[model samples]
Target chain A: MQIVTNNPLVREKLQDHYAVDYAEGSFGELLVRVRDKAHLGYRLLSHPLSGSVKPNETPYKSVLISDGPGALDVESLTIIENSILTADKFPVKYPQMSAKMRADFQLIDYTLLQSAL
Target chain B: MKLELGYIDIQDIQFSEESKIANGVLYVNKDEIQKIVLGQEHIRSVEIDIARPGESVRITPVKDVIEPRVKVEGPGGIFPGVISKVGTVGSGKTHVLRGSAVVTTGQIVGFQEGIIDMAGPGADYTPFSKLNNLVLKMEPEEGLAQHEHEHALRMAGLKVATYLGELARNVQPDETQEFETYSIPEGMEKLKGLPRVAYVLMLQSQGLMHDTYVYGVDAKRSLPTIINPTEIMDGAILSGNCVSACDKNTTYHHLNNPVVMDLFDKHGKEINFVGVIITNENVYLADKERSSDWTAKLAEWLGLDGVIISQEGFGNPDTDLIMNCKKIESKNIPTVIITDEYAGRDGSSQSLADADALATAVVTGGNANELITLPKLDKVIGDVSYVERIAGGFNGNLKEDGSIVVELQAITGATNEMGFNRLSAR
Candidate 1:
């Protein structure tokens, strides 16, 4: 499962499951990896997991694809990877913005996909 | 190769009884620099002045801006090949005056020299406005050829910068930034799974006074060749370009290249930043074809997966930009080109002299033809008396109110092609 987020705090909170940009020498906080999905489950259960960081408007948005457990077939995996790589959000690192620049960094729309195939 | 840049921040500049840096202030010995400049046969007179940041002053018909740097422990002196012997330089430590620059200004050399505003809205567009500028107001001898005058001014700027840089030889730098590039084998091994990348730096060398010098040799006479990215940090490339003011890469820009710096920021992680390919934008079609062919061959030979190509000047050079991109992309190497537009005053005209569908990822510096009015300043540093004759200025450009209206192209570094500014179009 890949978690896509725009919130720096939410992104930072999900650190162990992902490579936080500052640690990776990158500015992006977009793609959060899940090495141990069970760890992700534990964190989600105990922490105040932000339900939907869906902003009202933004220059960018992401399509999150979440699959519940089980390994996927090869063909289905390739298609999903391609879909995730293409038709995506802005491919840049998170910019350091101030609190006063709220309207500038607002995310307008989002789509979350839960797959059962 | 490895290089260390020692930056000594100069917060202020003044002329005094002696030349030295004391407590972040630089005291220049004017007579010494004047003698060096007048050493040239064609230059009749040289006047020096200082334009500090936030001052209500404007410097016009500017030729080049150079950051004074001294190589304290390098293979060769700064500005090698031209001012110094053509020695292989790019390792060891070099000292720089971080917040200062040498600006050459005088009578117009081409329709393209620039204007530097010390204050007001126009100051926001050009980077030179921030530095403590040491302005060289030079006057050429009567009937001196434009080519000779340009050469004299170019040499003067280099020599002056070199002289100032010498002051920091023993002073300790406030900060140090190190840059290095491994050999081919080592680099390949280190970048095993990373995407291979290179920077294709296109220099303007159409020579109606437009040119760039490489290691003392003229760039227009060279084939597309590979240069160590580290070498540039030590002043391997020199700008002799006389293109329009907006996009020409001044000597200062060459020293502080943003593309090279940005690429270096991610050199080891995001991509295997290989090296740089220095090519020229020649006026002839045969030369253009040959240079582009060689550039693509070098990129392919290096096994590059992607490349960032930055351009200098506009108009005729746009063809060179397209040819370089099309040929390199033809080799199956993805490319991103950096350029500015001449999209007309209304932003409806063609942006480049040539175009292709393959050039999809273009980072525009902005529209050079867009018009802007600069308010009159309390002090005119270099002589804006002849503003109407420059490239983007018309007959009645300077008005009765002393304020002048001209295309964005009239301002120096207003739309630098290296993505140097935050200005962009919708």
Candidate 2:
């Protein structure tokens, strides 16, 4: 399995044990990257919208996908596409957050990823 | 199983030298609550305050809201497995301190914690605004991990609420209501002519900050199972998640689940309310498939004619809701789903992340993205600086004049999927 995330905590903590693909971008960009991977037959192991935290509300997100390519999973593609659309619906407002708040978001994202793993 | 809820009406709350209930007023000894919260070494300090109905007060970054209750004559105590010992509850009597709640607030654990405005345009969005809230502003010890911090806050609220619930043990309740559920054979025989109905409750259990507990067991780890509806009333389910503020089911919501209450109202008269099927919205695909499959299998096994599925949170859980609805409907059992929308500011975007043709009957809880401006109130209970970071809040949401602008999502229970609030779509 491979982990795709913009959360530094997930990338930093899981780099040695997992195939961590760290994306340095907004939450929406991470989903787009995941969608691109799904197009290449990487089945989604976790729901793109895993946590209840809305798409654009938090700047961090992490998703798990199959390590090896296989037959194109239409369901995975649909979910990623829908997730991107959902993320687009919310106004793009990445407000400045304090260091403490950033750590909290990272920790939450990391923990959510751990639940799926 | 049968559960009797005796409600002791609490008109007002005041801090006094001694804790007691008198003439509909709940008087609390502040020091005792402080001691209970301080027992958790991770918590540095706690400040107790009261926010009454119609007061121009705003409590931000609110964590959990719990209604105080005590098991008066039950085999098990309230919040079994967590506060009390692990045992089967839901039979016998439980006392509820109605009109009052324990509202926990402190540093922002995540961006999901919400706002509760006592009296303002914002108050209409949240049901908690109407309740006399015993607010606890707790500060955690520095360097505490997020997981530990959430646990401390959750336990503090439960412990304090349980303590307050103890006060009503000897006091006479102002009103008493009874709820009962039956075994499958008994229900089949007693209400033979009526249509069999069941409720599928989807719990929020994504991760550390977004988890729900069933008898102290994390819900995500449990498969779909049948439970007595009254079990929920006696604190069988507990909310430990920090999912979005609007739809995240607080502990109070579990204690007085509107779906259970409404279904019971129509029980026997309109239909045979059978039992409740509890399921979790897990993050993993396999877990979701397993849970949804078990849910449908159980529904079919029970021979249910109709079902009402209520979802907690949104996005990923929307997939679980649709899966449950489609699978159950495939069995020829009709379902009416209750959910809220994130239809964007213009009300144009799709409401849910997942949908199916089988999910035709739906009850909406308005739009979470519908923006609303709240005028400044006289008092602010918690730190308002966290507004710009909350789920429904944006940059420059809090104005210099003290008023704030945000989506309905920021208000606690603004669009509760359980149909708890009056907000709905045409």
Candidate 3:
């Protein structure tokens, strides 16, 4: 049942529905649609969840695929263990700067996805 | 065989007597400076006396002081990592000067920021390491003898300036394909950088040690911009240690010529600077006219800032004897006069003796060693003015007197040996 949800944060959010989703056996693909229009043109793409769900069963996933405009930071993940935390959390230490420049630093986007199993 | 990549780390540190909360991450090479990251923490503060080889990385809190900068020596490539302190108005930039006020050679001072200060007698801090020759201009003052000394001293300064100039060219990095204009601190992204140099010129009147201007250049690319580095003059180019005086060449044989004394102050110490003495021996003598005229013309061409003419002998003896003595004296150059006797061995003296009715005249400006005796228009081998062209195109002439009067301007391969000589001792 734990393998149904791949992301740690997504699994933690799905703890209440685990018993019900496991018995039903109904399944759907977890789909994340992104709308980006920063550049001259608009484009769209589907972000699949990390790792496989089960045979005929959908997997749960959350992916951060976009950042600030003209951003270079991008990554895709494949789930290995459902209950395990797969994302490495490196500390972000910032140096001192004037108060005005501090406002420019902000988290842009993230997502949480769960399929009906 | 594998090429070992050499590493250098520049610590962004400040030494301010007034503050504590230092800011900025001290950039260091991770491979060489493992001690800085031992705790997985960014280095906050530490005092370092000096860095050892391989373990040469240092980290300190960055404050308001100027950061360490880079300097290029001759042919040796770039010598990076130097810091200096900047002073506010009246905070005493002159106080940082090391050694005696009478410096014989140039000296470098490392301060807090990435700035290096160079001070000394006519110091020239250029990128090229191996300097071979130099040209120097002296300040103006009163008196003719002072002017002659100025000429001799200028020769001295030319030698000194050459040494520092060549250091940059000599020590360039092997990896560098062409000359670079910027300072290369470790870890910083390699881009075009700025070259640091210190140039000295003099202006009399506000005192000998008054402030002067310095120009920082890219050395690899453009010429320099002379900026006053003090509050007194701001960043103006035509400030202290420089002044306006007479034109390029004219033997102003008076007691108060401006170009005379300043030149002496510039180059009197180093090198074998020879002095040439000119005397007014013939106001009307037929025999001495030739030598006097040649000497006068030579002086005019050299254009020394100092010249002195006297109207009297040792102890206020005669008032009306000296011609244009006061004019030269007012200029504050050096002066001397031979009022006792009059004689001439050349036709040039006739023109000088007839310049004024005074018994004596003294003037100052450039000096040369080999006394030139311009033969009669028939005895002459070539036009003296053409000496410059003759030097490169044709072999010099053999004077009738058997002495090889080398055309001074034309002598080739005279390798600015004087340039290297100044740096050799330092």
Q: Rate the local accuracy (lDDT) of all candidates.
A: 0.72, 0.90, 0.20
Q: If you assessed candidate 2 against the hidden native complex, which CAPRI class would it receive?
A: medium
Stretches of candidate 3 above 4 Å error?
A: A1-117, B1-348, B351-354, B359-426
Positional deviation of A39 in candidate 2, in angstroms?
Answer: 1.1
Error of 2 at B232 (Å): 0.6
Write out the backbone clash pairs for model 1: A27-A93, A28-A93, A55-A107, A56-A108, A57-A107, A57-A108, A58-A108
Highest TM-score: which candidate? 2
All candidates' TM-scores?
0.77, 0.98, 0.17
Runs in model 1 deviating more than 4 A are A1-117, B108-112
Report the C-alpha displacement of residue B13, candidate 1, in angstroms: 0.9
lDDT tens digits, residues B68-141, model 1?
A: 99999968988888877888878999999999999998663323347899898889888899999999989999
The digit string of per-residue lDDT tens for model 1 on A45-73 reads 11001111111112222222333545533
| lDDT (Cα, tens digit) per residue for candidate 3, span B126-195 | 1011111111112222322322332222223322222222222222222321111111232023321211
Interface RMSD of 1: 25.5
Worst 10 residues of 2 chain B by lDDT: B105-114
Error of 3 at B233 (Å): 15
> Comparing 2 and 3 by TM-score, which wins?
2
